[model samples]
Target: MTMPDINYDILRRVAETASAYRYKDIWITVGPEDGQLVIRVHDAKPTCEDCAIFPIAKVDYGSSPSVEVATIGSESNPVDLLNLEVPAGQMIPAGTYAADAVFWSQSAVEKFMIPYYASVYGDQADVVVQTLLTVLKPAAQDGSEPDPAFAIAHLPGSEYVTLANEGLPHLFLIRQSGRVEGAAKR
Candidate 1:
């Protein structure tokens, strides 16, 4: 199958826009069109912690970084970010407790987000990456899948994704009650 023609500069521009304006709840996805890549970024109003945020891509397992850039875009409504509320409280006793969780894995973030953030933030890119990592899961020294903290520090912006969209979009509908859509499965 052939791909679409993508305007890569657009992706870079969008990333620059996010950084300049400090948009929050940013959701980015990449697709192919006419032999090119079509990138989508769900833009949303900055969160309360708007002052700080997150990145895109700089990925590799055992390969050199590619020069390919994608065309980034947005739907009618973009995305909103969710942050962890560091509650002021006493320390809790350490004990084993089973729990459930759902999050974009650390490797996922690195493969998808790090490059984007690194594009703008340079060496300090991991700061926001770490932020999103916390919400998605836990931090790790090796920078692979995070150690599950059994909590979601961040989540999709429910406002733009569900309510504002006016219906069940494929993006959000893919996950229902912990069962990912068949297409999402390997």
Candidate 2:
């Protein structure tokens, strides 16, 4: 299969936004929405009382990086970001964890997330990535899926991980580990 044509700059911008806001944990996801690649970032704090606590920014490809600059390109196919709420009490169906191992194994994880965090977080990116890997890798090996309550981290530091968007179809998750757990609009 042909690899998804990912615009890495867009991912980097979202990562920068999360870092700028100093979110302890963040959820990032990118996928086709209305025929264009839509990326969303959310504060992944388990107890976030309101979705407004998270600043949602969406930008088109090749646009300047600014939370205020929502529209980066011409009127056609402008990147539209939706205010996606993190999951609260929804039930994640059993076997949701089945495909994580295959998804995380691809170069996409590094090609997508690791470098973006490295660029945005600089020296601290290692710790962030390590913490993520340390937390999620064992589950991958054991074939145990992340429960709806399984958060990668919740402390006040740079910690984030890319997961399959639970809001979209399972096929999307099978292809890319990009969404924050339960952070997509269902």
On lDDT, the candidate that comes out on top is 2
What is candidate 1's CA lDDT for residue 98? 16
Residue 154 CA displacement from its true place in model 1, Å:
12
lDDT string for model 1 (1-186, tens) is: 323333544445345434322323454444443443433444543232112223434333355334333211134422121111211220011111111112345676557555654664455446545654444344466856332232221122221122211221111211112212111111
Q: Report RMSD for candidate 2.
A: 17.3
lDDT of 2 at 85: 22
Candidate 1 RMSD computed on C-alpha atoms after optimal superposition onto the true structure: 19.6
Give a tens-digit lDDT track for model 2, residues 1-186: 222356555455455446434423455544445455444555553232211223444333454334433221236533212211223332122212212112233344455555744665565567645543433333454546543222221211112222333321211221122233432322
- Residue 19 displacement (Å), model 1: 12
The number of clashing residue pairs in each candidate reads: 22, 0
lDDT of 1 at 175: 17
